[model samples]
Target: MVHQLAGRLNSIDPQAGEALRIVSYFDVLIARGVGLDGLLRGAALLSGTVAGAEIRGRVTRRDPDGHAPADAADARRRSSPRSHDTWTVWLERDGEPGPDDDMIAERLALGVYLLEERRRPDSGIDAIIDPNRSAAERAVFLARHRTDPETRVRVLATPADAADTGAPSAIVPTRYGLLKATLDRSGRLAPPEPAGLGTWVRADRAPESWDAAIIALRLTAPDTPTVDATDLGAMLLLAQAHDPQAPHEDVRALAALDQRSSDVLRTLVEADSIRSAAGTLGMHHSTVQARHEALTATLGYDPRTTTGRMRYTAAALLLRLIDPITPARTPSA
Candidate 1:
């Protein structure tokens, strides 16, 4: 009977024969309770096709269910109407024509699901974004999935006050060998604005890369569409330390000043000289100089001095991190 079935499959298409044989092997492995790693490898080997294969799963905003992994048959029996996670098996081939695309794709998805249920501890992005996951766990999970040294990860995050309505976010890797060109072209397209936060880090450092991505997102100007983690300097460190309710003594001091006064101090700290500061702010050089003197009197130090510049820069960074929404120049002072 099996031989007859195989003969019939081959008569229809040689590819169909191969697909059935692979599916049959998957069934046997499912019965034997093989892991996802085993099932995926076996299927790829049986087909003797596909350059690469992987299971891509959707990321839900919430945690996934804790049900044990089940075989393809069980998955068919107990499929749910609503799933927080959905997965599909992706097969890649350079140029060879596969026997049956749709049929093999479906069977591969089923096999992947069976093993993935057992292997995956939690949903992908959910685990990364979850505050409850230890740094160790996040690093481990992210590193495991992004094992390729050349793969770069990008993250789009918004400030707490920013609305969530924006361009949709994507977390998938770029198709091999196209990432750099794709990234370069992204900024030149219509709408002509930067898009999202991006970072390039070794796969092992995913957690740190994510941290930088989020920081860059917050530091970026509202008009700019994208920000790279590498461009951020001391701002990254300051953003990391920011806690709105717990401003430092110097930060509080800077915050208490009227807008113009704070702006003048911030400008002085950032500019190369008083003349340059005045030029940037469109203020008279003497006016800036006078404000600098007054700031020195108010803060008990001259911000133009070396030590004062350091302190003032720290305060300015804190202000930006904690109150990024406020205008840099206020007229009230």
Candidate 2:
């Protein structure tokens, strides 16, 4: 089984070697009958952030001021989670999904993979700065200082291969009909096709190889709940590209409108809220519609599509709004 998995890793693309670590984690886990869901629940306990992957806590320590090293297992051991010893969380084994030696090896491999991927530049997208912007200030390092003033910034990225490639592998393989759904949720492995596989497929007709990457930014529409540093960087770039003066946001106050009239505008954007903004705000359906009307009069963009949202959020954050070059208001996200 180890040999088979090794061969699979060898077959992965060179640009994707960094991500196979995550694959190895799952490979070992599935070989032992432990599924990713178990890993997910286990991960939630240690890391405050829960992701649908084999658990190895995120470690963000990349600032001028030294910070503590972050690790999933270490975090789990240290955190005061509710389910430290529920005992109900048993490992499957012997034809059933068990968290045995094989599972341990796989999960560990996954951890290593994610760790290395975070270090990769491609996956390490800068959320604060837009790729379209000019000057060093348009980079994540500089832009973060402007976005969130009170933040203690710590940036995390998906594994390099994981973020750039196709759909992740779906463990607990079911019938063929359900394979795509399973892949979509795993968020680990990658496939080349998008039809029945996932959304990470390559496109030949694109203007550049990055066409798929650009499309992904548009389609991902990541909810605030599932926000990742890499995705955040992508959004910032998209926002800057949409409007140099606007910031990307779910909803922002329209300076031009009165509070009462603005409330109605918020309702419009709320009704057709983009990605995860609606869920984050715990807002009503009409909220997006309400916001849209106001944005149209102010930020100069639509909130319904990716370009629009990018413009809106940037305007909201004032990505490049340029307000007297306020001395780096927010710390970071």
Candidate 3:
């Protein structure tokens, strides 16, 4: 029955696969018939830890109807039509699992419902605008930053070339392997303008309201690189399910199984060898030389130097894509 229930629950939401994994992890505990309370607590703890979130503790007694307890009922309600908590809040709270394995089920439903509601409203810009002082503040900022030079100012200045201007300048090569920007006016850069934030945010801001703040908290890292969590997690889970205790050796073996070219490149990079990387990786020396040569041709520099390493690192990330931990998140009340 538990297996049947789990199979049904697993199919409920693709996004909540990780939670299913936790359930799978505790399947053994459940089958042991260690009492409903013990199983739930075990599920909760395992789910919380791996999902990097929280779940409710165990429930002592079953509900009157011989169904899941009342708290689970309330939780299901809250997660569905009456989800009061935001995404961040939902993830952070220690909500309990319902008696039925409907936690992941409802979360997916709620997500789809909310998405539909958003589309239905179709409020567009009006929905997003702060409605209060958002417009006023923007106006004020524009008024200050707006410049009025006597001669009609160039409304939009094509980026300047200052090497001739005699000021110390740095020419940044752009994506197309061309000099893109020349940083002429600056003082050691005011700690790199974080790319993710914009004018919508305030200078003296509540960290919660700021894009950078919310993002910094929610994200795994500044440059964690976005991924389809479901796919990555599933891959990780599949690999782990095959061999949980042997992750290291298994991962290495799995990594080796990746596309031939990528594996060799990664192996060479890790070993810091440019020469025999081709032979050991099963590619011809000429092919390796051509790839190496083209690496420079495409990126516009030598691969042995720091500039080359930057290109190599970028490629390496794609080559060494880590199999996800087989479920990005977990579920509960």
Candidate 4:
């Protein structure tokens, strides 16, 4: 039996036996058609450590116990050989590399690549969002697919999951980073993921919607997951024109504030009264007042005043625009 042969091989040569076991393990996973989560779980269990993968902008990880930790730990990583540098798999281990580390990483990466390839749609969604594609070509693809004229485009920090309603989606490369773009006919604003919702447009004008969606996505923050293009109004112009590379004095000043100060300032700006801000921040009104005065002195302007509020709002928006929380890379493909 293969099990008897494997046992004999293990007794004869430990390293070779381990390698064979690794190969067989992944082969069975592939045969079972496990997804990224399953693949990471399998790798973690086999290595007795944590395993993770970053495909496009979506990150998934599994600890050895099969639990998904919220934070990523330091780990050794390997890029998928088959992808165009779009994906990577890593093992979070403490000590020196194991003898089978290379083999485990290689199989993990390959499995992730194959799974992603299988999930890729053979549809016009790619062409419709591709900026380099000619308008005529995009139009042709739209017509071929019979896309609705009222469809809106949404750009997300992560890929859509099974919970999401079925929509034509693709990974779009943007100046900020790779984002998962989806075409939605539902016209709903609430998305489970952090997203930028674009304006409703005809199939031929989808590119414009795509552009607006990217801007809206950049404006989203942890507290604000989804931003609608329709809600932006004229602020969209500011986002379009602002260059993240050049930090203005106000932006620089705002950036210098510590987390505590930043939270207080944001609460102050949104709250109608100091008491309201204090309640929202879960701090005493007197304590909030003191902090507000201190922030005014530190910021060189009272954020509560009309003119000061405008300045703080602009600076805050500009800050979020320049410093997105998620990590992204330029498209290699």
Which candidate's TM-score is highest? 4
Deviation of model 1 at 112, angstroms? 28
Q: Which ten residues in a row have the lowest lDDT in candidate 1?
A: 173-182
Q: TM per model?
A: 0.43, 0.21, 0.25, 0.55
State the lDDT of candidate 4 residue by residue for 236-321, as single tens digits.
77777777767678898998898999999999998999999999999999999999999999889999999999899888887877
RMSD to the native, candidate 4?
15.0
lDDT (CA) per prediction: 0.49, 0.32, 0.32, 0.70
Give the per-residue lDDT digits (tens) of candidate 3, residues 1-333.
Answer: 233434656688644554555434443442233433343344335334111112133223222233334343234323212232333112112355443334433332233223323343322221222234454453442233331111111110011121222322222111111111211122222212211111122322211122221122122233643222223332333322333223344234334443754454455555455667776767777887676675445445555566656556543332233322122122222
Candidate 1 per-residue C-alpha lDDT over 84-119 given as tens digits, one digit per residue, 9 for 90 to 100? 144434333444535554444444455444355445
Clashes of 4: 0
Q: Say which prediction, candidate 1 or candidate 2, comes out ahead on TM-score.
A: 1
RMSD of each: 21.5, 20.1, 18.5, 15.0
Model 3 spans > 4 angstroms off: 1-261, 314-330
